[model samples]
Target: MEHVVRLEQVSSQLLAVVRRRAGVRELSKIVPEACGIVWNVVRAQRVAGAGRHVAVYLDDQINLEVGVEVSTPFAGHGEVIGSATPPGLTATTTHYGPYQRLHEAHEAIRQWCASNGYRPAGPNWEMYGHWKDEWNNDPTQIVTDVFYLLVADGSSS
Candidate 1:
């Protein structure tokens, strides 16, 4: 899949998430479960203007947090917890297809970082836009934004 990777600055944002440690294959089940938990919390709290769904991958073991963006931090309860998006320089790209095709967008960002002399400094994440009914008919209409935090000055700490 063709992708356009760009270097951008990201601001820290609040999140309501369900943290889990699962392999890549398990994410298909884990993500939806987490989303369900988070959405219920959002509705109960009556948080207006909640943003898109997000999955923050902290490691290969899939230390993941399935979440939705919130305007401010809140006390977490049960499986749903509060977190913040990492802020700084990042390599970003948008994937326009089904979730299964998301790996291509990640690979594209990795290649962009390598060729551009940047190195991943931290975990990466994906922000999924609001779902559309038409996406069922044309999966390519689905949108997901991928972000990889980059090391400052390309230096290893």
Candidate 2:
């Protein structure tokens, strides 16, 4: 799919996350498990949530912070702890399709970055839109935003 990629400065989005070191291939399984743990903590503590989940990829090894968005930062419950997506200039795109195809959006951002001479400065992330019942039948309704934190040099122009 054609992704409309853009560069923007975004503030950190606070999350209750669980850190995990998984291989690229293990993400599909591990992320959900970690997110569930994060959610459980949110529920158990009655933390106000924003109804969305995010996964922050910290490195090439696929070390990541997977969790749901919370209204405010809170204390850790075992492995689930407070974290946030890094604030910086980023190249981002919104993918409207099934989650399994989110790689396309990430690739689009990478391609855009390469052509535009913007190197990734830090972590990248995916903020998943809230689930809708209709999305079950219409995969196009699913929304996942992909972002790559760009090196904060004056090269974004």
Candidate 3:
């Protein structure tokens, strides 16, 4: 599939995250569980705009933050911790398919960066859209946005 990679500025976002060092095999199990924990906390705390979910990859480990956008930050408790999504210039693309195929989107971004004289400056992340019933039957209906923080000067910082 053709991916349209674009450079855009992402604003800082509040996140409720669970940080862990695990291989790709463990992500399927860990991410969902973390999302559940975050959701429960959001409900209990009555956090507004609690819906969007994010999985941020910090190095080989994953810091999966599942929460909605909030106007302000909140104190973190237990496994649910408060953090800000990386904000700056980012190369982003949307992947339309099952989660298993997300790597293609990442690879496409990497290629786009290299060809355009840019490089990943920091951690990357994936923002998952609201789940729809149709998505269960049609994997292509699922949507995910992948972002890679870009080096300020198009070179290693």
User: Among these predicted structures, which one has the highest lDDT?
Assistant: 1
Full-model lDDT for every candidate = 0.89, 0.88, 0.81
Model 3 vs truth, CA RMSD = 1.8
Candidate ordering by lDDT (highest first): 1, 2, 3
- Across residues 83-147, which tens digit of lDDT does each residue of candidate 1 receive? 98899999999999999989999999999888888899868999998999999999989999999
Angstrom error at residue 140, model 3: 0.4
Model 2 C-alpha lDDT per residue in residues 97-136, reported as the tens digit of each score: 9888999999998889888888888699999898889998
What range of 10 consecutive residues in model 2 has the weakest lDDT sum? Answer: 148-157
- A best-first ranking of the candidates according to their TM-score comes to 1, 2, 3
Query: Where in model 2 is the C-alpha error above 4 Å?
Result: none
> Which scores higher on TM-score, 1 or 2?
1
Candidate 3 residue 12 C-alpha distance from true site, Å: 0.9
Residue 4 C-alpha lDDT in model 1:
100
**Candidate 2: lDDT of 14?**
87
